[model samples]
Target: MDFWNRNRAKLAEKRRLRAARLQKKSNPSSAAEYQEKCKEASRTYNAKRLLAFKKREKRAEAAEVKHGRKEANRRQDQRETARDYKVEYELMKSGAEDAFRERVMHAMWNPAPGEYRIQFSDGSYKYFD
Candidate 1:
């Protein structure tokens, strides 16, 4: 059994080597053609990869610009809110003490259900229902 197995293995190896030699002699141009095709494929793959990278960079730049614009707008909105609050505070400080007290009393006396008084920067009160 061991002798038969060794003989079979040697026969298979000789058959494989013979087949390889036959194939190499039969198709000599196939190797060069394969290498040319591989080079072309690699070139196209690199071109596509570079294009994708550029597109990704462009998108990232646009996103950064968009984020910057949004941040600027947010800062502008915060500044406007602060300015409005400052103006309201100044108006409240500049008004006479008696007038302020009278307005508060008037609002308290006219308290309506489900309505709240909103004081404006101009020292005027309005009911928010």
Candidate 2:
């Protein structure tokens, strides 16, 4: 109980000092100074925030440009691949036709006795009457 009483007095003294400090800060001159400090702090904070926003926007634009280039390259690669495949198919088809023509010419030029060449629908040749 004695300790509590002693502490209570100390608490009251501390409260008085805090109140006096608050009262001093609430004076017109001190209030103006405090407002100016607050304004300066707010300005700095807003400037920092604006700079960060601009940096983020720049990064986003760069990323979009990079993505666009990548997409264009991908499309170009696909087109090239398709063109290559078409050319390969055409070359293979021409080679097959040439081979078939050569075989027919050879058969016509060298006919055996009572043997004739017959062509099937599946691009095959057989010996028949």
Candidate 3:
């Protein structure tokens, strides 16, 4: 397989292995049990997201009332800026770029970028971003 397919396969295998390891501790006897666990996870994740959004809205409104909507928005924007900065930190790592790279495209104009390896005389290769 080519690099992109190989990389995707590696990632998929890693996910499967991790899932197997995790599931061993909480083995559900049936598919229905697994489905229930998945639904509960989805529900919990959504509830947390909703709570966060509500908190941000309240903070924004409070800021608007005390100061001005512009300042409130600016503050909220700063928080988002910080969050994005943390998310982008992965880009600094050579291996982490693959996680952020857009892999799913309806129009396959080109294959995704691959980390090309430079091989030395002794058959050892150096990985580069």
Candidate 4:
């Protein structure tokens, strides 16, 4: 064999010997000691798993509360918008905000063929031929 091959084989042998020595040193000698080690490892794993579950649950609760508030606020805004459009624009006497706004948008963007829509700075609009 070449010199390089011989050196490589020696290095591999040294590594194998080192691994064997480490395994022998760490090998548990007593049954009670082994059982203690296993129990400790199990306890550590269970604690970590419990901690992770708690964190996940806490995050879910926070997201639910945040999304719940958002939904409530959105509903309130829609009701207020519907009320204001009824009062301010004198557009319709009664309708949901969604329908009212859709009607307004359709009128604004797609007026009659010859009619033009104009928006003033004060939020009022007019239709003219």
- What are the lDDT scores of the predictions, listed in order? 0.71, 0.70, 0.62, 0.69
Compared with the true structure, what per-residue lDDT tens digits does model 2 show for residues 21-106? 79768798877887899999999999999999999999999999999999999999989866744543453345565655543433
Please write out the lDDT profile of model 1 over residues 17-113, one tens digit for every residue: 8887677567868656766888999999999999999999999999999999999999999898668556544434665546555434443323668
Global CA lDDT computed for model 2: 0.70
TM-score per candidate, in order?
A: 0.56, 0.57, 0.33, 0.52
- Per-residue error for 67 in candidate 2, Å, reads 0.7
TM-score for candidate 3, please give it: 0.33
How much is 31 displaced in model 3, in angstroms? 0.9
| Candidate 1 ranges with C-alpha deviation above 4 Å | 1-26, 96-129
Best candidate according to TM-score = 2
Q: Candidate 2: TM-score?
A: 0.57
- Worst 10-residue lDDT window for candidate 4 reads 86-95
Quick one: ranking by TM-score, best first?
2, 1, 4, 3
Clashes of 2: 0
lDDT of 3 by residue, 61-102 (tens): 897787886788899998985574455444424345455343
Q: Candidate 3 regions off by >4 Å?
A: 1-29, 68-129
**Candidate 4 structure, TM-score to reference:** 0.52
Please say which candidate is ahead in TM-score: 1 or 2.
2
